[model samples]
Target: MQQPGTVDEVWPSHAPENYQCPFCDMASGEFAFPDNLCEPGDLVYSDELVLAFIASHGFDPEPGHVLVTPREHFELLYELPDDVAARLMIVTRDMAVAIKRAWHPDGVTTRQHNEPAGSQHVWHYHQHVLPRWNNDGLYFTPKRPIVDPAVRARKAAELRAVLEGGPTRH
Candidate 1:
């Protein structure tokens, strides 16, 4: 059931004091932290409203997972504008197609989290686009370490190449 609600009543931000937002840094082309997981090289796609990049962390046996997020920093889904939300979905779907073209997996999966209880680690709202194979165990697998920059870059390059070929055909 859908519950109509206001942002304040439904979503409370969980960011710590003086938190350095990694997604914002990536969106701004300023991935400037020594320990930040995301890097500029991980970026696969970006428009005025959204950005898609390979996730630094990935599920085992299914590396190079992608994260699609809005350009602005919205700590939780409750804060996203309707237009931003629509753009996120559009980008998410395109990333799925790109992943399919690049990896040829059996299928694709999309996931998003809200608060800590909902498994959201980063304060930014992101939708995950994961390529799925039978028995991949994605739901059961914990995230692996932050992938190496070169590897992430290679994956990003693959997706970017696919996306650059223009919109996918039906």
Candidate 2:
């Protein structure tokens, strides 16, 4: 399915000259998330098309946050191919389910940002799947800081086990 706006329309370029895309390097195994926040062991799910893993940062009430991204670098929602978008959505759904099973959160939320105005920090496209609860206070809070690598790895393993049909908390 096509996105809301014209598929061929060009976006006002916001990228700087010689801009180094961090997601590209991460996907390519060139740069690792600082302090091992995201390591290969943190990968919960992946295929030839997409990668799903625990994000470094976690919301206050629920720390079982995840991110699903295209294996190749696509800057924004409008730039992603239809097939890639479909795959990412599927992975995101799977991750959401796994989070629910593993963490037993009251609810789940999926988020995607576009350009800088839309709060897209990293240039590469990604979908955030987070567990949520009523009155969890996430709405008023600032973006959470990156958690310790050990915690991230443990959470990743829990979600991966759930997704893979291995032992899980629930």
Candidate 3:
């Protein structure tokens, strides 16, 4: 079933661009996408081989979350060549550290790989890092707030700092 509208626009259009994937195309700058999506585009960190970005269709299971992705657009973790798989950990680690320091969250949750039975939405391989709160009207699972712009800026700063080299204090 459709997980709502986020993929609606992205999915159908992806096929016509000569079999190109939107995420990969977006990361490659071969197409135009929304700007200032998360302080400065969905992409936060990108190199010749990898790219990290804040999730755009973030009607999230939890708030203050981000997604780190690879440039080549592998469909699943197992699809990645060994070298790419290793780099994914580095990106995940860096994102986790930044999320911890910036959000002052009670903890962070890391998850990857879901299935038809596991509620995985996008087919592309990516990692999710969710910032947690303490007794913040959330329980067994989590909830997303309206995500104010000011908070987004602060978060961008926090992630940027962590990327630069800040302590990942709890």
Best by lDDT: 1
**lDDT (10s digit) by residue, model 1, range 1-170:** 22244333545569998888899989988778656888778999999999999999888786889999999999888777778988999999999999999999999999999998999999999999999999887776778899999999999888777666643222
Off by over 4 Å in 2: 1-10, 32-37, 140-170
Worst 10 residues of 2 by lDDT: 1-10
Instruction: Estimate, for each residue in 1-170, the C-alpha lDDT of model 3 and write its tens digit.
Output: 21112211322211223443556666767565443233446667777777777776553345457787788866665456556777888888888898888767787777886544555555567788777776554335557778999999999878676555632211
Stretches of candidate 3 exceeding 4 Å from the true structure: 1-20, 32-40, 59-62, 136-170
Model 1 has an lDDT value of 0.85
In model 1, what are the clashing residue pairs, if there are any?
Answer: none
Off by over 4 Å in 1: 1-3, 6-10, 140-170
Question: Where does the lowest 10-residue lDDT sum fall in candidate 3?
Answer: 1-10
Give TM per candidate.
Answer: 0.76, 0.70, 0.60
Could you give me the TM-score of model 1 versus the true structure?
A: 0.76
Please give the CA lDDT of all the candidate structures: 0.85, 0.76, 0.64
Rank all candidate structures by their lDDT, best first, as comma-separated numbers: 1, 2, 3
Q: RMSD in Å for candidate 1, one decimal?
A: 15.4
Better of 2 and 3 by TM-score: 2
Q: Per-residue lDDT of 1-170 in model 2, one digit per residue for the tens?
A: 21244445566666677667655655777564453346665678778888887787776755668889999877788777678888998889899989889888888889999989899877778899988888887754677898999999999878766556632221
Model 3 quality (TM-score): 0.60
lDDT of 2 at 44: 84
